[model samples]
Target: MATLKVLGAGPVKRGITQIAAEFAKASGHQVNVEFTGAPTVRERVFAGEVVDVAVVPAATMDEFAAAGCIAPATRAKLGHARMGLAMRKGAVAPDLSSTEAFRRAVEKADAVVANLANSGNYVAKLVGDLGFAADKVQRQPDAVKVMEQVASSPQQLLGAGQLPEIRELIDKGVAVELAGPLPDALQSVTAYDAAVAAASANAAAAAEFTAWLATPAARTAMAATGID
Candidate 1:
């Protein structure tokens, strides 16, 4: 059986994992998928890991293509991830209908928690732009840890991460409630893509798997996982 190594970010992780399982069963290939922060994904690529396919932010795909790590022509966008907020369970969910309201909410919160990658970076800048001290933000290395901090905190902390991840945490009873997406004006969306590695000996198999990721069945799985 052909084995494909895949690396990617958190937003599409659940969907991608499910897709990989189905792909393996149908195509008779083994897929080893790893999901991490976007920056780490880039680091893995730059370090020359034997990755057959990479599913990361679209912008990262450009970087990988420029570095000749992946075939530019094979890039296929999977989906977009929107930034969102999560508040402790039993806490009042704030109105985030506008950028002004979001700013105000952040100002009133006792503390704000966010992962230092992806959506968290955007939240950091938004906090700074809103006149909050950048250093005041609790920056964690990963979304799961960020939510863990928020869930265990007694203070009113607002945690931020990619919407899909936050939703997953809520489903898993992380003591957080979905406070909705960031206001449209300050909203950040990341489009994820999958591309075959340029150095892959399994290019044909990798290409087929990546192509299958864009099919209707895959989309259905993505939607079910809150990726879309």
Candidate 2:
């Protein structure tokens, strides 16, 4: 019964947490995961923070493979997380049926809240391209905080984050509700990957856990959390 230490990206926290429990039950291995922003995950791994596994955006996993921090052969694509919008629970759902409607909704909202992560950066640029004032987008440290800010706001602020993050907050009844995904043209999908650390003490168990991420049951669990 070896314990595996994992560093995972925040956007996939809900799905990964669920799957880690399932994996632990089936394999009798204890999986401990620390979740944070994708950039921080890369930074820590590059700084030689030792862990049995690392789960992050696919591109960052590529970087880790190149840096020899993760075993190339153990890397597996997890799933794609799409950008989505959320509002305070009971707030009127905004019209996101088309690009123009999305723009109008953004224009009318008191503010657009987003985290300082990959999905938030994309949304910031998106609103900028739409001619919305940059000041209208409020940036927070992470998705959880973004949802919290929107949920607590008395104004009609829209929260932007990875779909899974938003869905998790809503499922937890965090006083926020999904307003659907971003418009097709304005959508951004981030693919995630998981890999065993090359220097892991429990390499075999870590490899087994990473491999399980691609299983059909795991995929279904991820999809239920909006990680499809």
TM-score of each: 0.96, 0.95
lDDT of candidate 1 over 12-51, digit per residue (tens)? 9989999999999999999999998988999988998878
Q: Give the lowest summed-lDDT range of ten residues in model 1.
A: 116-125
| Residue pairs in clash, model 1 | none
Query: Model 2: what TM-score?
Result: 0.95
Best by lDDT: 2
Report lDDT (CA) for all predictions. 0.88, 0.89
Regions more than 4 Å wrong, model 2: none
lDDT of 2: 0.89
